[model samples]
Target: MDFDHIAEKKQEQKATVWLNLWSNRSPELLSMQLAKKHRPGETVSACLWKSGAFNICYRVRYKDGPDVILRFAALGRAILRREKVQNEVPEVFGSGICWAGPYIVMSFLEGMPLSQLLKDPSREGRPVLNPQISNRSLKRAYREMAMLILELSKHEFNSIGALEENKRGIFIARRPLTFNMNELMVSANLPEKQRDSVSSEEDCRKKFTARCLFLNITKELCAEHSQGPFRLYCDDFRPSNVLIDLSTSRVSGVIDWEFTYAAPAEFTYVAPWWLLLQSPEDWESDLNQFLIRYFPRLRTFLEVLCNYENKLIEQQLLSESQRLSPRMEHSMETGLFWVCLAARYSSMFDEIYWTFIDSQYYGTFTSLDDRIQLLDQEQQHEMNELVKLKTDQSTEGKESFTDHYPIDKLLEL
Candidate 1:
C-alpha cells in the first residue's frame, strides 16, 4: 500500500471512459444524483475538470441555479475521512459510500489558484517559485499558511492514525495507513529475474536487520510521537492545495482534505517544506539557488510560527525545546523536518532514511551510493559483523513491531 503503488494501480485500471471525467464523458447515474443533490429543479450540465489522481471533479452546473463540484472516487476512498470542521473544508451536499469506493458532491469555493500565484514557470513544466514570493502580498500567504498550521495543531489525539467515525463513535484507525511500507516491495512489478537476483533468505534477513538498525532512531521517534496529542496533518500541505483571495491576502479555501490524519504534533514543530514549495532534493532550480530564494519566505514562516509557539507555551501546550525561536536557521538544521519526513513517508526509506538522515547526521555528500566506489574492506567487514549480530537478536521479531520504544522522549523534541 505504498503511495506510489496505490496511484500506479489506479492508473492501470483507467480503461473505462466514464471513469475519467476529465475526458468530458460524465457517467449518467452519477450526474443525475449530483444534480438532484444540489440542483433539484434544473437541467444538469456536468463539465469535466482535471483534479488529483484520486478524484474526478465535475463542475455540475444548473440551467438556472448555482454550480457545485462533484468529486467522484475515480481511484479509491483511501484518502477520504470525515472532516472535524465542516467550514474549513468544502461543504458536502451529497455522499456515496459504496462497494466500488465513495463519492461526494460539495459546494465550490471561488478564488485564484494558489499555485498560479506562487509558482514561477520553468522548463519541463515543474514549478519553480517566483522570486518575489519572499516579500510583498505573497508573504501574507505564507504567514496565513503558518497560522493554519497552528490552527490545525489545536487538535489533540490519543494516538496516531487516520481519523474515522461511525454510529459508535470517532476513533483512531486500527487498520494500516495507505502509505504502509511492508507492502511496497511486495507490490512492485519487478521482473522475475530481478526478484530471483535476491541473494538468499539469510541475506534478506540480514539486510532487513541492518536497515532496521539504521532506521532505529527514526522508527522509535515515530513510535514515541504516536502515543498522544497528535494533531491534524495533511501530507500534501503545499500552497497548491490552497485557494487565495489576493485582494485581502487571505486563504479563501483549503481544499483537498484527503490524506488528513491525526499525526504527531512534532510534524508541525519544524519549518515546513511548503516554504520552498518543493522538496529540497527535487527543486526545479539549482538547490542552492532555490534555498537562496526560499530562505526569506522560510524565515517569515518560522518567525510567525515562533510567535504561535510562545502562545502555545503560555497556554502550557508547548515547552522550550519544542519552540523554533533559533534552531532552524541553517541548511543542516532542517534535520527535524527530514526526521519527520522519514517517519511519515516510509515509502522513502532509502531516500529519506539513507540520504536525508545521513546528510542530516554526516553532512552532504558528493555521491550517495556505494554503486561506483564500493566500501573499503575494513568498513565492509565491520558492517557485515554488525548486521549478523543484529539479525540474530531480531530472530524472534514480530513484523514492524516497536513495543519497546519509549514515549517520554517525544517531549524532548
Candidate 2:
C-alpha cells in the first residue's frame, strides 16, 4: 500500500480499538469490576471518560465520594506493572482482566490535565511562550513542579532499573522498562531484543548498535557525580500525565507511572522537556527557532527550581550537596538536555544527534555519511545493517501497518 493508504489504515485501526473499548463499558460490567473497592450495587453510572494512545479510561460515578477511573489497556496486554516509587500517584483499588477488558481501578483525582491549562492553540505555528497562561500562574505551577522534582530526587536507589515486587512483596530492582522501549515493542511490532533476551545475536546487534554508542558517548560526557544512586525517573512525567488545579495553580496528583524507573541522576538533573508543551525533536520549526522560544520558559523554570532548592535546604529536607538546579541549568547550557532526550527516544535520535548533539562534540559534518566515517569498522557495519533492516521493514508486507491493522468492527474483537 501507499503512504496515504497506510495512514488511513492506522487511523481505522485506532478507531476500531476505541469502539471496542467504548462498547465494552456497561454499567453492570463497571460495577462488577469495581465491586472489590466499593460496596456493590450502589447504582453507578458509567461514561466514556478519556482515551490515551495506549489505554481508555471510564468515569464511573456513585452518589458518594470521588468518581472511580476504570482503565483498560487497549492492546490486550497488562500496562500497569508493579513499581514502588513514592509520589503523588493515586491509590490503586484493584487491577485484573474482567469481561469488559484488562482493567485497573483507581480512585479518581479531581483536577484537569496540566496539558489543558498549558495549551495555547495560537502558539501552534509560532516559536513563543504560551500566551494563555498568566505570568503569576505559570510561576506558581513551576514552583510546585520544582518541589515535586526535589521531593522525588530525595528517594534514591542503588540500581539503575525499575522496582518490582518479589514473592515476599518487597520491591526489588529489575530491568528498566522505559517508555521508548515500550513504544518500540508495541507500536513498531518489534520483538523483545534486550541484552539477555533469547533473540538471535544479529537481532540484538541491530537493536543495540546505536544504543551502545549513545551509552558510551553519554558516559564520556556526563558528569561523574551524576552517574550513580539512580533516582526515580518517569518518562511520561510530562504535563498531560500530571493533574493540576487550575484555580490554585498547584499539582494535585501525578498519574501514569507505567514508565517510571530508577535511572541515572542525570535524567532528573536535566530540565523537563514539557515546559514548552512540545518535544524539541518533534518541534515544527528548526532547532534554532524552537530554542529561541524554549529558552525563555526554561529560564523561568530554572529560576523557580533554584528558589525551591534553597527552601528545601533551609527546611533540612535537602542537603546542599544534593542541590540539582545548577546541574539542570548546566544541562541546558551545554546541550546535555538534547543528549539525554536522544538517549531515551530512539525514533528521534538521528534528527536530534545530527541537529543538536553531534556538532557540539565532534564538530559539524555535512552529512550522516561523514559522521559514520568517524565510527570504527564493526560499529559502521552494524549501523549499515540496522539502517537497511529498518528501511526494509518500512516497506515490508505483513509487518507494514496497512496490511496488519484491525479494520474489523468493535464486536469482532
lDDT of each: 0.54, 0.64
What are the models' TM-scores? 0.66, 0.78
Off by over 4 Å in 2: 1-18, 21-28, 31-43, 76-89, 121-129, 165-170, 192-215, 223-227, 246-249, 279-282, 366-370, 383-413
Clashing pairs in 1: none
Query: Residue 310, candidate 2: how far off, in angstroms?
Result: 0.9
lDDT of 1 at 291: 54
* Per-residue alpha-carbon lDDT of candidate 2 for residues 1-413, written as tens digits (9 for 90 to 100): 01234333454566576556657666446554574454343535777676565566777776765667866666422222222222113576667555544567777788887767667757654233466678777887678777778877887777777666547752535677777765544344343121122134444343444355556678787757464777878887777777887677778888877677788888888978878866544576467777787788888898888888888789887899888888888997787898888878765675576678766776765654555556689887776676555555544454434323233422123
Candidate 1: worst-modelled 10 consecutive residues by lDDT: 404-413
Quote the lDDT for 18 in model 1: 30
Worst window of 10 by summed lDDT in candidate 2: 79-88
Which number leads on lDDT? 2
